[model samples]
Target: EPEVTQTPSHQVTQMGQEVILRCVPISNHLYFYWYRQILGQKVEFLVSFYNNEISEKSEIFDDQFSVERPDGSNFTLKIRSTKLEDSAMYFCASSEALETQYFGPGTRLLVL
Candidate 1:
């Protein structure tokens, strides 16, 4: 399957600001997910969406974060308020089922 892809490979923002990360998951995949890896920490799952609704999400995905499928091919992750800790590499992924996922190159966000 073709891998997922994210736009604006890098982003720089100020604390308390908002950022919307865009993604295009594999066309045929039914499940899409967002994850982030801090500079030195393990990759952490943020949220997963299917059939236009969120199927699951981690605690880290609080009110500050949201996911949406605005169209047939575009999926988006919006961070309502940025924080220094929000700096990380955000990855978009897609899977045929709940199994193996194909990850994108990632968008590196730097909150200053």
Candidate 2:
């Protein structure tokens, strides 16, 4: 079955650098999203993208974060400033429809 995939299962970064986490969503899906879960905390929605622009976003998706579909098969999330609080498992998800989303295993980001 086709599934969303993320690279660099775990990343250890310094407290003030840029990082780009990559993902390849399901080929046929129309909607894609980014969600993150701080270890032991609730999963929080970051942003949703469709038709090449942001469809929706939460407060957590501040100026530090950006998402893009750089090609037909890949999507990416770039963080401009890494903060200690930015440590979390970032999940990439895709859905044919809007409500139900299938998530990738997740890219664990740790800012030290």
Candidate 3:
């Protein structure tokens, strides 16, 4: 079965450093998105990318964050400066339509 894969399943960084998490969604899925879950908090939407541009973004996606599909297969999310509050599970997802999304296992990011 086709599925999303994320590299560096776990990441740890010092506060103020930068971090980049990668994902490879099912090849044929057309839409990509990034979402985050702080330890005890609800899942939050960060950004959505399509056609090589941002289609939508949430308030959480501030200047410190960015997303890209540097190649045809890999998608990435970069945090220019990590903060302790940024520690969370970051999930990448893809969907053929706007209604349903298939999510990656997620990369666990820990900031100190």
Candidate 4:
């Protein structure tokens, strides 16, 4: 069975610092996405990447954020500058199609 994996399960950084979170999805999957949940808040979509290009992005994915697929197996999310409000649990997900998405455990980010 294939599953998504994330690194640095928890991170703490000062405001204004840059952060890069890493994820590796199931090998045969075609679609990738990033989502975030602010503690008690609901999950919100950040961006979706497919075929080496961004297929869709939300307003939350502003200039401050970026996504990349460094190699055939790894995907990354970079936050150029972190803000206190950016503290949240970030999730990486993948799916063969838009109907079902398999999510990673998540990386908890805390900005102080």
Candidate 5:
């Protein structure tokens, strides 16, 4: 079974900056999602995309956050202005059905 993969396994950034995290989900999956875990907190859902549009998103996914499927294999999440609280391990997940999602290793974003 293919798994989702993310780039730049670790990232360090200054506050109020912009960051774009990348992911390559399993080829056959149709739904994609983004989730984040602050240093010691539980995983929190950010957004979900399907068919090139956002299907569902959490309140945490405010105006500063965006998701894109720029190509067939690449899915991206962009944070327009990073806040100190935005420092977290961002995960990418994909699923053929809504029930089970396979997660990537995650991109660790550190904001100063």
Candidate 6:
């Protein structure tokens, strides 16, 4: 079975720095999304991308965050400027039909 894979799995960043987490979604999917969960918080939607432009974004998606599909199977999320509160597990999801979203293990981001 195909799987969504994320790099680093965990990252340590300093406040006010930049970090880019990478993901590779399963093949043949069209829509990709980014969600985050703070240590004990609920999963929150950050943004969704389809056709290379953002399809929908939540209020939590501020100027500091951006996403891209750099290749056929690779999706990336960039935190332009990080903050301590930005620490969370960033999950990458993809769905072929928008009804079943598959999630990766996630990239745990820790900002000091």
**What TM-score does model 6 achieve against the real structure?**
0.97
Q: What is the per-residue lDDT of model 2 for residues 1-112, given as tens digits with 9 covering 90 to 100?
A: 8889999899999999999999999999999999999999999999999999999999989999999999999999999999999999999999999778999999999999
**Better model by TM-score: candidate 1 vs candidate 3:** 3
Give residue 33's lDDT in candidate 5 (0 to 100). 99
C-alpha lDDT of all candidate models, in order:
0.96, 0.95, 0.96, 0.97, 0.96, 0.93
Over 4 Å off, model 5: none
- The lDDT of model 5 is 0.96
Error of 3 at 38 (Å): 0.6
The weakest ten consecutive residues by lDDT in model 4 span 96-105
TM-score for candidate 1, please give it: 0.97
Clashes of 2: 0
Native-referenced Cα lDDT, model 3:
0.96
- For each of the candidates, give the backbone clash count: 0, 0, 0, 0, 0, 0
The C-alpha TM-scores of every prediction are 0.97, 0.98, 0.98, 0.98, 0.98, 0.97
Off by over 4 Å in 3: none
Please give the TM-score that candidate 4 achieves against the real structure: 0.98
lDDT of 4 at 110: 98
Per-residue accuracy of model 4 over 1-112 as CA lDDT, tens digit each: 7899998899999999999999999899999999999999999999999999999999999999999999999999999999999999999999998779999999999999
| Candidate 4 residue pairs that clash | none
* Candidate 1 lDDT tens digits, 1-112: 4778899899999999999999999999999999999998999999999999999999999999999999999999999999999999999999989999999999999999
Those runs of model 1 whose alpha carbons end farther than 4 Å from true positions after fitting are: none
- lDDT-wise, the better of 1 and 2 is 1
Top candidate by lDDT: 4
